[model samples]
Target: MALILHDVTFEMVPTEVRLLTAMTPAGFPSPAQDDMEEPIDLASWLIDHPAASYVMRVSGHSMVGAGVADGDMVVVSRAVEARSGDIVVALVHGDRTMKRLRRRGDRMWLVPEAEGLPAIIVDEDVEIWGVVVALARRYRT
Candidate 1:
């Protein structure tokens, strides 16, 4: 799938949201808390090196096994060096794609997390664009 990238623009003043001190449990019911912690700046918390990061909306199921789904937004960071096993946004033969980066000795490959998808051997035509820093998803409109 072709990657659709959106530039991240931050406001001059950061927006702070109230943060709860309690951690919500996923497996069992937990006691709720009325306590409020210090407000958090989501943009700062989510995006490290804001000047070198951008957001891209995912458009394929190739990364479903990695917990990244179609329609999710991933924050890509160019400031971070792409490493082996890193989920990266890359330009493959001039086409952009998001995949897991794998390295074996001197060779590298772009591997998909889903079944039946072919892994692409990294060649001179491929360029690692950025490393995936964070993911964002909305359950409802």
Candidate 2:
């Protein structure tokens, strides 16, 4: 049998945290679909913070090139800033999805990598949920 390995790290910091009001489905605009996902148990899957955090299983093949395939779990950092080349969770027309971010003329656009897909143009109706900080994928036989 072949052994599979992953890197591990540790960081220490203060316990206090600043809070941000979460934007809900009602607040999402220009979404592709209205689907609410079932939340996952964080402790068993990821590192837990004392403050509030949520996890969503990624769906769709739009981000397949980036390795964020359908049913992969992406860890979103609500605390991180969205940069030009970072992957993000966004609400478009009330639909939540994972996408890569890019800057346009004073605006940001969400680009999907799956072939035969059109980019979700971000407008006044779109909201960036959070920046995708980590991704975990499991191989299957």
Candidate 3:
């Protein structure tokens, strides 16, 4: 199976697909009383929420422009709506990548967070697995 966002579809190799599903968020949260500042555990919320969850570690600088760098763990939710210019995870040529989603009319482009990676124009076959919701990175001292 592949990831589909809108009309764009991102296909991955079987190994990558397994990796994507295997790496999950750390915790699942229970519900809390209203008006409380307690946060909802994303892992658990995803059970009822339409989005799928994955915790992926950044391994390149291509997305440093988006504050995602090597060693950063991104919390990606597949259920969120992917709008134009949103950061997303996509598979390009059997490889998974994190990039900004930019749509132009019926055409779309994947903008890399890392400098120098050429912008990729996507066809209908491009799969957009999900929108990135939050990023957790370790700061280097």
Candidate 4:
């Protein structure tokens, strides 16, 4: 299936909570919150460049090693500069794909996290849409 960009605009919801000071352990229960400071807007915290940022639903597992699993909604920012080692949504040969950006001298490549998958060598026509900033996925019940 082809990748689609679903344009989204955020209406700031001032939702804040006391973030726990202690890390919850998987093996056992941990102590309660000792302290937390300031109210934080989760949407603002996640997407710094609000005007140029958007979200998309991921459908592939090629980026699983990068913690971007299938069925996850990834936040992307067009204003955020795309650098080497940054996970980006790009257009390769007219096909939109999500991969890790890698630059070697003057050449660019899109690498997949899966061991058996092959890397995509970017041609002159490639267009980088944006850099992936955050990912959201719901746990199965």
Candidate 5:
């Protein structure tokens, strides 16, 4: 399962979010105010380097504890160097997998956040695709 990065570029269409001046509490229903701030570009805020970033849909519950849920879209940076404790997409023996990178001395480990799953020890041949920078989720379709 080799995941290849397709050479693709597109115009950045930013989603504008309404900035509220006051914090609305979910526990208590408060009267909505008409106070409006400048619209913020979520694409600019989420992506630091758009040229090096790509989005992919996640699968399975391997990374639930790390805030990455199934069907969530994750922003991955191919140009970013993956470090220890960073969640990354990697090719382990031709199989693409998402896991947290862990390093101890000369050994590397791909750790899963879900319980009952075993961590994988990195072999001699491994290709790290990118580091997961941000996650996007939808509450309702």
Candidate 6:
């Protein structure tokens, strides 16, 4: 599966959303709390460097195993250095793709999360564009 790249632009005004102080549990139900925290700017919370950060939409199932499903939006940050085991947006022969970065000794590779997909050995033609910092998804649109 291939990924499509898109540039994201942020508005001048930040949109604040109310954040609950209580932590929701995934395994069991917790007591309901009425505590309300300060409003949070999602864009600011997700992006560390606004000038070098971009949001791209996932178009394929290659990263589904990594919790990045199709149609999900990922925040990419160019300010951070790409490290081994980090999910990154890469340009392979000028084509953009999203994959996990792996470093074995001096060799680097781009690995897909899905089965049957071959891992790409990083060479001169491949460029690590940015590292995935955050993921956003909506259950209903």
**Model 5, 4: alpha-carbon shift in Å?**
14
How many clashes in each candidate? 0, 6, 10, 0, 0, 0
TM-score of each: 0.82, 0.59, 0.60, 0.78, 0.75, 0.86
Task: Indicate the residue-level lDDT of 59 in model 5.
Answer: 64
The alpha-carbon root-mean-square deviation between model 3 and the true structure, to one decimal in Å, is: 11.9
**Between 2 and 5, whose lDDT is larger?**
5
Instruction: Tell me, by TM-score, which candidate is best.
Output: 6
Off by over 4 Å in 3: 1-51
Q: 3 or 4, which is superior by TM-score? A: 4
Per-candidate Cα lDDT values, in order, are 0.82, 0.63, 0.63, 0.78, 0.77, 0.85
Q: Assess candidate 3 and give its TM-score to the true structure.
A: 0.60
Instruction: Please tell me which model should have the higher lDDT, number 4 or number 5.
Output: 4
lDDT of 4 by residue, 65-117 (tens): 88987788888999878999999999888878888999978988998777877
Candidate order by lDDT, decreasing, is 6, 1, 4, 5, 2, 3
| Model 6: CA > 4 A from native | 24-33
How many backbone overlaps does candidate 1 show?
0
Error of 3 at 45 (Å): 9.5
TM-score of 1: 0.82
Candidate 5 on 27-100: residue-level lDDT in tens? 55345654786888877776778888888777666677888877787888988888999998888888778889
Question: Where does candidate 3 have its weakest 10-residue lDDT segment?
Answer: 11-20
What does candidate 6's lDDT look like per residue over 5-77, in tens digits?
Answer: 5666664368899987565556443457547779998878887688888888888787888889888888999
